[model samples]
Target: MDHRFVGIPELTAVPRVAVVVDVMRAFTVAAWAFSRGAERIVLAPTVEEALALKEGRPGWLALKDGAPAAGFDAVNSPGLIRSRDFAGRTLVQKTTAGTVGALAVADAPLVLCASFVVAGPTARYLRAGAAGPVTFVVTGEDGRADEDLACAQYIGAHVSGGRVDPAPYVHRARNSRAAADLGAGRRAGCHPDDVELCLEVDRFPFAMVARREDSLTVLRPVTAPVNPAR
Candidate 1:
């Protein structure tokens, strides 16, 4: 298998597997929600699309700017969603980077949304299914987040059967300007608690696989038929 890492801005080919990396918050929240029992995650290209989705479902939660959209049950914040009971609810997600990145590569055969929380399992899953080209799309806040690319590199390295310490990259993320802004002064966009969850590497044992369902791309964890190659 040939694995390569590139920022979302540079992605071109439609590989066998396209892993969308958004460790900042979107996918971190996703991992938390799935871990806590959310049935599936539906990615919306924009707030408009997400709103349209809510119109059809009428009860699914909507998230905007990391907070629950008006009248929704929960927000996109992992810290917030982890406390809510989402046993069978399908979450509608719209975010700055994660979902956008996923939609950007809709041509790929296999699209997997991942964060640091599921990095190891994601790597394992990709390794098990390796048959050809695999590309890691680092969706970093409009191609400016180092942490996102760092995570992509981390996963890519692991996929190639290489070892790299994750602590330094995680440390860099903690002290990043974005982290500082979100932790010290922001309450609406992100907070310390949110960053904390995003940095929990390998917290989940499954990877979120995105499957296109008509107009929606749904993400669900595949946990059966373990086939770890290494």
Candidate 2:
């Protein structure tokens, strides 16, 4: 399968499979939430919509980043997500980049939400099931999210039938401006531990896949073996 990397603006050209990457904390948070037993996550393109989904709904929670929404349970930080008990809960997530990117490619045949935490499993899933071209959507401003781009490269190298050390990519992500902002606590509702949490490669053993469920784009975890002798 041919692997192509594109940014948010190029999403309209996406082919069969589209992987939306947001390592700076959006998809990472989803990874953690799924690992923690979240039943399903609804992707919201806007903070207002996410808040609307949570209204009067039992077992539903809203999570977002940037200026706080009125009823959001928490921010999109993996550090905070790690300790929460999300068992049987449905999360409505609205992020500055990641969720928007995923929703943008909702028309694609297959959509996968990705971060370093689930990169290995995602790559394996693609190798086994993807029959057409795969596109990695880097969900950052101006198509220049260093950490997200690094994660796309890491996963792409694996899917290309070769394995490259993830060290360099991890290093590049750690020193990125986004990492610096989170490390210095400049971003609202973000924790200092989030930088490390987002950079932890292969932390979870499942790939987060998105599917259209009625009017919502829902994400759930799919566990694929590290190496399948197919």
Candidate 3:
């Protein structure tokens, strides 16, 4: 099986296993949310769909801007999840890069969202009998952000029977434009604590595996991580 790290721009045919990396905040928040007891996360491709899902649902939904909506429990903030309890709750998330990329490659047989938070588990999952080619999709802020690319490589190395020290890669992401976006103070959603939380590699031992549910993808944390693929 071929394991490759690639930017979204160069995508051609989808792989048998496609891992979407959005370390900036989307999947990072997802890892923390699952750890915080979130039952399941519904991936919404558009802001309108996310809000619509939350109309009569039990869980909350965040806007594409990652802001706290009126009826939502909290925004897509890893730091926020650190302080709240979303136990048994469901969350509808619509992000610019992460969700967009995940939906873009919905044709792939097995799709999972990963970030530094669940990087280790993701590697383990892919390494465990996931046949055919594996494509690591880096969901950059717009094009190719350094953080997501580094994360894609970090996971790719492990799936390819190699190891990578995350320290240097994390350091590089800390100085990337995506990291800078969090520290900019221009966006209300980005916080210092959130930035720190997003960079904590291997913080969670599970991966949010996405299944093709009807027209959209629904994500749930597979504790075994590898079992989801097998």
Q: Over 4 Å off in model 1, which ranges? A: 66-68, 162-164, 224-227
Over the stretch 24-82, how does candidate 2's per-residue lDDT look in tens digits?
88999999998888999999988778888899687799999865557998788888779
The best-first sequence of candidates by lDDT reads: 2, 3, 1
Leading candidate by lDDT: 2
Off by over 4 Å in 2: none
- In model 1, the worst 10-residue window by lDDT is 64-73
Cα TM-score of candidate 3: 0.90
Candidate 1 achieves a global lDDT of: 0.78
Candidate 1 lDDT tens digits, 119-211: 878878777875678888878765668778777777887777745688977887787665666677464655558788888888888888898
lDDT of 3 by residue, 1-230 (tens): 57777667767887788999999788998888788788788888777778888886644654345666665556666776676677888888888788888887888888889999898888887777467788888888544789998888888876665467888889988998877878775556666787888899888888778888786588898864443432
RMSD of 1: 2.1
Q: List the residue pairs that clash in candidate 1.
A: none
Candidate with the larger lDDT of 1 and 3: 3
Stretches of candidate 3 exceeding 4 Å from the true structure: 58-64, 225-230
